[model samples]
Target: MFSKIVIACALVALCQAGFLHYHEAPIHYSAPDHFTPSQSYEAPAIHDEPAHEDHYVDEYAYPKYGYSYSVEDPHTGDHKSQHEERDGDVVKGEYSFLQPDGSFRKVTYTADHHSGFNAVVHNSPPVIHNH
Candidate 1:
């Protein structure tokens, strides 16, 4: 019980310190007294740009991500995998799993501007055991 209490206190202190470290102090600003209306300083004149003038800017951006995961059967020493990704207007995904008879099955998906959408599946032939 004492050790638990000590660990809890240490965790609380660490969390408090982390919060304080990441916190930012607010900024306070004030204009100098010399800029008040009583001073003779004149404000600068402003000019407006003419409209209908063309301004050009170009940008290229895309998002792409992919990750894979696997689950293993601790007793059987077998595993399955899954993955997915998306780039710009295209997306793809897949998953594969092991079968009980020493075979694997895989399924996939794809979509894009031209092909629209499609799904494909493949299966490994079941293992044949001969006596």
Candidate 2:
């Protein structure tokens, strides 16, 4: 009786596997000769100005959530840009700059996701009057 039951189960399993294989589509294969390889070409040379002592400076205001952080170049009694980020969070920070017109501009960044976010304080420097 046990042998009969085992045979019956095996037959059912075999039927199911056969049905699945019968319904499955055949694999499609393409020969490598059908593909066209791209030709090798040299890229155009890009000219960029050489970096100097004051070429570029960046700063960041990291989050205080026990996450790893780094500040490239913080306020050094001079003008510079800043950026900061926390784990699984969009980068948030502020930038204060002195315009070429001898005025100051303050910009605050709040949760800058790829979509975008609110900018509470966005003020530009007022025109300076040279006496």
The best candidate in terms of TM-score: 1
Candidate 2: 10-residue stretch with minimal lDDT: 65-74
Q: For model 2, name the residue pairs that clash.
A: 59-82, 59-83
lDDT by residue (tens digit), candidate 2, 39-112: 99889999997886755556665545432333334454355454544455665666666555656666666664
| Predicted structure with the largest lDDT when compared to the true one | 1
lDDT of 1 at 66: 87
RMSD of 2: 24.6
**Relative to the unseen true structure, what is the C-alpha lDDT of residue 59 in candidate 1, on a scale of 0 to 100?**
67
**For each predicted model, how many residue pairs clash, with residues at least 3 apart or on different chains?**
0, 2
